[model samples]
Target: MPTVDAVVRCPIAPTFRVSQLAGMFDLPPEPHTERRFQVELPGLDQPWQVGLIVGPSGSGKTTVAAAAYGRRLRKRLRWRRDRAVVDGFDRRLSTRAITQALVACGLGSPPAWCRPYHTLSTGEQFRADLARGLVSPGKLLVLDEFTSVVDRPAARLACHAVRRALDRQTFAKRLIAVTCHEDVARWLRPDWVLRMPEGTLTRRCLRRPRLRLEIFRCRHDVWPLFAPHHYLTGKLNHAARCYAGLVDGELATFAATLNHFRPDRLRISRLVTLPKFQGVGLGGAMLDGMGSLLSEAGAESITINAGHPAVIGHCNRSAKWEFRRLYKTGRKPSGMYLQHPHWKTSAGRAVATFRWKFS
Candidate 1:
């Protein structure tokens, strides 16, 4: 949710194994999870040299990367950028500290004035941001959501850059990546692989396996703004809860669920929210809160059917869902579920109905 922030301190013990790191972050240990459709990576390795993690959208891969990176932060660190003005703090320091921190992350020399952050390409920004983390003495490079938005070629190039950097380094520079695209694996050739499934982790050692992608449910208030048609299945539907995004009491998002209460679980007939607040983590918060609320009320899991792949992907990325049952919708379910200019379509299109379970 907080795009890999620069924190005050990373709590990694120098003696902890990679599996411990996985457990700390709630990832599946190695040798058990699949990658690249045929590999299983183990997690008991120590001082990991380099590894690539691949999974489908919303598979909690980034969360795993964050945990590993956090564990590697027990050493001194800094951040660097060649020509971009570094703003924000990893809770490390002011502007001056930022420049030095970049070097500590691995930059040899930083430009006097950093260019504006927006003008840079996503790949450059990613490398530059990572430079800050890399400079840390003995720091493990944790790259989260490594290639979600970049073009395929750029992702490959980025992977090459990282590999080159690690290969040339005289000393060990541990590298770990969390990505949804398996395309980059051939070049990365990670020493280990970790896969995150619905509510659990499967660790693999070396060989990647075919991933079974699934979807989950979340509520965003933007449904009225960008997905109104999807919400109204021929009728006005309310009763969804909403939230204010750090904007005291505005209800920036909302979610509605028609439930079939049972002894073991709660089957959701409907789940919807506004589109404006979809990707901003409000939806995740809503789903998490709702899941907890339902669980406390005697529900073992939450289940739903959704036609939107984006919804499923969001739920999957959340690491909160468990069981997923995909199903078809109307006889002639047109792809034209919701058409909006503001939303990005390259991620994927919505299905007729997505079945989800919460436990």
Candidate 2:
């Protein structure tokens, strides 16, 4: 649920066409960087405020989207561009609402009304992140590796959902999806298709992406511990209380407490995955799981201060979260990494913060 203004804008935009993209990718014919191809896009006559960039892995799909959006943010010699602005947002509100906002951004549908991101399937998080990109009005939505984790059926369903959402939009919104999957072309039914092979780009008319349905049930009483623990600990920013994924009624992994504290508008003070579940997905899951709940609580959005790309990816991808550029921390940051400064000695810390949200 970040403010629209906070989303990073690329520094420049390029007038990309199939030929230019193809040349840059070095498809079949090798061309010098300066020898740009006269671009040809038969389908694109009018200006495409929104666009889709399709390519395989290592084909620079993200690079293209990034470049396009950068240009969209820039003021040209003839075109007057307005500075992007966003409304006020807080990262501490309801998680569900945040999930909705993320979905609006193009991440995916929020988890169940109350379930946090930690409890969601990985594919669900992908959709949530897609939704997040879509929330901002008039911004182009770009998704790389658009549907890798999901089975074909689920991917199709997700594609259809997004297509429906975009097709029904009141304002102008663009979508860009990157994938090596040839089948995606058919399922997504995109207005434009840019195919990349061996680092070269080309155009193709293929089938759209497919839609699929999938479901999983909690094997135990897993939903009752999150907010309860937050309330008990008096740390409203606490992200989650459980670590182990449930297999039937037995705990398949270790248990731990995960929490985060936003000391300022720009940084998080405490982010701990605890000891037992240190290397597991607990910390990341908590952030993802709590996203929806935080949004529902009335926060405009959520933010995380993380350096580890893995953790960042968890929030940005596994949980469908976005990030601002890394803010430089002046002092040695404490809280989640080491000991939480808020801990008023051992007495308060001993209360295992391992609570659940399902109840």
Candidate 3:
């Protein structure tokens, strides 16, 4: 292992407001000081993928990243705050790759992708930044203030998703994350962690949290909370029976099952998972659980009209569901088209239908 060193010095003025306040409190009016960060990290000789520098605010995490990785780091991770979410990456990458990166990072909504970065929610923007970084990854990728703006659950989910994405890549790269949140340590599963505040470094043997999902019947009122995350924005069918999946008593996934026109059949009219939780397969798990429950209750089959490519691909790959057919729906010239003008294109959009039959 090779050693890396970083030193930051900020000269303090005795006449500054902070120094005056300290003097009033009988504390020493400290002078200029140098803060040092040194670590024995896996260099060109060793096999290592991820590195973490974590501590509270003003703890020199960003300084350490800057000192260690330098200009290459800044160039690779720079986010265009003024650009639309989908346009914030290398133009050389295929559209599929860009969309895939965005989906993997949990900002999979089509509408959100079209909007500018500033318009998105904090969580969405966080995911969009991750997606942009992953689009054209370098030998070293440095991220500052990782998950600082998002909630704890979102932070963990983003960490897990990012790790998964890195694992799937065929090339060799290193990810250095500077964050204050320690809760994501287990989810990130980095090769090493440097706790800046404690001045301690340790190799991580991480254990991921076991996600316990509970599915039960829910009322129509809960749909409003989840409707915004869905790709198709419209009013949910009121007559449908809704089911919500909860992880640790917080709503994670939702689906609406309704009686089909045929006998002994049901259709999933609406399915959605919260944006932060989307990439972790929670939506598919909820769909399977609901299908199992309906099967036990004497339903012959359950079907779904899935337009999202991710959902369609999952259903096709799953043993529990069989792909029925792929077809295109006629263009709607009503309020739906007025609200979502993107669907006005005459290009035939493909929709995949799937069915799960109880034996």
Clash number for every model?
Answer: 66, 78, 0
Give, for candidate 3, the lowest lDDT window spanning 10 residues. 340-349
- Error in Å for residue 142 of model 1: 2.2
lDDT of 3 by residue, 48-96 (tens): 6888889998776677667667764532244567777778778887777
**lDDT of model 1, residue 51:** 70
Query: In what order do the candidates fall by TM-score, top score first?
Result: 3, 2, 1
> How does each model score on TM-score?
0.34, 0.36, 0.82
* Cα RMSD, each candidate: 21.4, 17.4, 5.2
Assess candidate 1 and give its lDDT: 0.47
| Candidate with maximal lDDT | 3
When summed lDDT is taken over every stretch of 10 residues in candidate 2, the lowest stretch is 76-85
Question: Relative to the unseen true structure, what is the Cα RMSD of model 2?
Answer: 17.4
Query: For residue 78, what is the lDDT in candidate 3?
Result: 47
lDDT of 2 by residue, 1-359 (tens): 11111122333234357468768888553333321111223232344433345555655555544444444331111211231111112334344444444433333211121345444455554554454455544556556667777777556556655654455462256666766666655556676555443333344434543212111223224433332322123343334333334323333222222333431112222343321122224445455544444445444435554443335545554425554444443234355535666642233211111111222
List the candidate 1 regions with Cα displacement exceeding 4 Å: 1-47, 63-114, 170-172, 196-359
Candidates in order have lDDT scores of 0.47, 0.41, 0.77
Error of 2 at 6 (Å): 27
Q: After TM-score superposition, what is the CA distance of residue 148 in candidate 1 from its true location, in Å?
A: 1.6
lDDT of 1 by residue, 73-147 (tens): 222223344334465345454565555333222221223124555555555555555555555455466666766
